[model samples]
Target chain A: MPKIVNHEERREQLAEAVWRIIRREGLEGVSVRSVAEEAGMSLGSLRHYFDSQSALLAFSMQLVAERIKKRIQSLPQDGDPRENIEALIGQIVPLDEDRLAESQIWIAFSTFALTEPELRPLSREIHDSLRDVFRNIFETLAQSQLLKPGLDTELEAKRFHALVDGLLVHGVIASEVVLAEEIAGIVARHLDSLLVP
Target chain B: MPKIVNHEERREQLAEAVWRIIRREGLEGVSVRSVAEEAGMSLGSLRHYFDSQSALLAFSMQLVAERIKKRIQSLPQDGDPRENIEALIGQIVPLDEDRLAESQIWIAFSTFALTEPELRPLSREIHDSLRDVFRNIFETLAQSQLLKPGLDTELEAKRFHALVDGLLVHGVIASEVVLAEEIAGIVARHLDSLLVP
Candidate 1:
C-alpha cells in the first residue's frame, strides 16, 4: 500500500519549517529550497503543497494570524474588564518567546507586503481584524462603565490598536533599551486611564 | 583629462543611488551592480568604496542614520522644548515624501538588521542615538518644569520613543487604515499627556 500523506498536516509542517527558517536565519533566508531543506523534505514534495513562493508565504503568514487570534480567543471568559483587556493586548506583545517570534515574523512579512501586492490583502486583513479585537474590547469596557464618559470609542480603539503595534515593533527593534516589561507597564497605565474616575 | 572622482562625493552619490533603488525597487532589489548601474558608475568604482556586499549595506544603513541625525540637528535652535520635541519626533515620522522615502528605507534596513550581524551595530547605534534624543529631550523638559512631575524621564522617554516608532511602522505598513493625520494627532495627544498640569 502507498504511504498516506495528510496534505493539511504536510502544509503545516512546511510552514513550521519556514517559521524555523525565519526564526533562525531571518526572513531573507526563507527561500523555497531553504524551507524544503529545513523541513527535511524534497523540493518537489514541498512544491506539491505550495506551488509558488507567494503561496507558501501567504499560508505561513495566515497561520501566524490564526494562531494569534486563537490564543486571544482562548483566554478565560471570567476576567474583569481591565484584566481581560490586558490579557488580549498581552497576547500580542513580545511577553514570551512564542509571541516574540510571532512579532518578528509579522514585522518581516509586513515589509514584504509593502512591495508584494499579493501579500497586502493578508497584511491589511490581519491588521483590520486585530483592530476589531481592540474595538470589541473597548466596547465591552464602555458598556461596563469602565471607560470614561464621552470618550470616543472609535478613536480610543484606534489609539489602543496603534499603541500595541508600536510597542511590539519598538520592543523588537530596541529591546535592549526599551524593555518589553516597561512597555507592558505603560500599556497597563494607558488602559487604566480609560476607566471612569 | 580623466575627471578625478571625489571618493567621498562618489560614495554619497552611491548611497543616494542605493536609497533610490530601495525606494523604487524595494530593498530586495538592491545589489552592488544595480546600485552601480543606478549611479551610472561601474561595479569596480562602487567596490572601491564598499569592498563587499555587507560593507555596502552597512554604509547605506549608516547613511540613513546620519541623514536623519542631520535633519534633526538642522532644526533651528530657538529651542522651545515643545517645538524641539515635536520637530525631532516629526523628523523620524513619515510626514512628507522625502522623509517618507527615508522612513521606507529605514524600515527596510531595520528588518535586515535582524539577521545581518554586520548591520546590527549600526542598527543599535541608530536605535540608541534616537532613544537618547528623546531621553535628553525629556530630561530637559523635566528640568524645565514642562513635563509632569513624578514622571521618570528615561522611562517616559522610552515610552514616547516607542510610541513614535510604533506609529511610524503602522503608518508605513497600514497607511490606508491609520491615516497620517491620525498618527500625528495621536503623537500630539501623547505628548500633551507628558505636559505639566
Candidate 2:
C-alpha cells in the first residue's frame, strides 16, 4: 500500500516544529524554511501545510490556545472547589518544564499578535475566553455559597484574572527569582481576602 | 553660521521614530533603513548616531526605560500617601497616548529580549527596577501607617507589581475592550483590600 498520510498529525508535527524554533531562536526564527528544517521535512511539504508565514504563525498560536483549553478541561471539576481552583491555576502557570515552554510560546505569540491585525481576532478570542473562565470560577464560588457578601462577582472575577496573569507573567520573565510556591502563596492570599469566614 | 545639532535631541527624535514604527508596525518593521526613513534622516546620518541595528534597538529600548524612570521621578510625592501611591501606579500603566505608545514599545522590546542572551541583562534590570518601585510604594504605605496590620509588605509589593503588569499587557493587547478607568479601579480595589480600617 502507498504510504498513508495522517494530515492532522502531520500538521501538528509541523506546528510543534514552529514551537521548537520559537523556543530556541525567538519568534524571528520561524519561517517555512527554518520550520521545515527543524521538522526534518522538505520545505515544499511544510508549505503544503502552511501557505505563508502569518498562516503558520496563526495556526501555531491557535494551537497554543487549544492546548490551554485542553489543560483547563482536564482539571478535575468533581472535587473541593478550592482544589479545583488550585488545579486550574496550576495548569495556567509555568510550574514545570512543559508549562514553562507553553508560557514562553504564549508570550511570544501574544506579543506577535499585537502587531499583526489579522491575528487580533484570535487574540481577542483568547482574551474573552480567559475572562469567561475567571467569571465561571467566581460563579462556582457563588453557587457554593463561598463568596463573601457584598462582593461584586464581575469585579472580583476581573481582579482574579489579573492576579493570575500577573503571576504567570512574573513567573516566566523572572523565573530565576520567582518560585512556584510563592506564586501559589500569592494566589491563595488573594483568595482568602475574597473569601468569607 | 555652522549648522548646529543637539545630539541628545536628535537621538530622541530617532528613538521616537522607532517607537512610532513599533506601535504602528511591530518590532519586525524596524530596521536601519526603515528607521532612517521614519526619522526623516539619511541612512548615513542615522548610522552616525547608531553603529548597528542592535545598537539602535538597544538605545531605543533604553529610551523607554529612561522615560519610565523620568515619569516616576516626576510624580508628585508631597501628597496624601494614597494619592502618591496612585500616582506611582499611574506612571507604570498606559493611561494616555504617549504612555500607550511607550507600552507598545516596551512589550515589543521585552518580548524581543527573550531568546536573546546578550539582551537578557537589560530585561532583568528593568524587571528589578520595577520591583523596587513597587516595593518603594508599599514602603510609603508603611511609613504612613496605611498598611493593614500583620500584612507582608514584600509579598504585597510583588502582587501589586504583577497586577500592574497584567493590566499593562491586557490593556495593550485588548485595548479595544479594556478601559483606562477600569485599570484604575482595579488598582484602587487592590489597595483597599490591603488598607487599614
| Residue-wise C-alpha lDDT for candidate 1, range A1-197, written one tens digit per residue | 99998988988999999999998877778888998999999988888888877788889999999898898889998967688878888889988778888988998898888888888999898888888887898889878888877777887777777778878987777666666678789787787567875
Query: Could you tell me the TM-score of candidate 1?
Result: 0.94
Considering only N, C-alpha and C atoms within 3 Å, which residue pairs clash in candidate 1?
A: A166-B166
How much is the TM-score of the A chain of model 2?
A: 0.96
Cα lDDT tens digits for candidate 1, B1-197? 99887888988888888888888767888888898899998888778888876777778888877888888889997867787788888888887777778778778888888887878888888888887888888878877889876777766777777778877877788877677788778777777767965
> What does the lDDT come to for candidate 2?
0.86
lDDT (10s digit) by residue, model 2, range B1-197:
99899999999999889888888888889899999999899999999999877777888889988988998898887887887888878887888877777778777777888877777788788889999988988887888798998888998999888889889888888888788899899988888888986
The i-RMS of candidate 2 is 1.0
- Which pairs clash (backbone N, Cα, C closer than 3 Å) in model 2? none
TM-score per prediction, in order, is 0.94, 0.96
DockQ, prediction 2 = 0.77
Candidate number achieving the greatest lDDT relative to the actual structure? 2
lDDT of each candidate versus the true structure: 0.82, 0.86
List the DockQ of the predictions in order.
0.64, 0.77
Measured by DockQ, the strongest candidate is 2
Which 10 consecutive residues of model 2 chain A have the lowest summed lDDT?
A188-197
Q: TM-scores for chain B, in order?
A: 0.94, 0.95
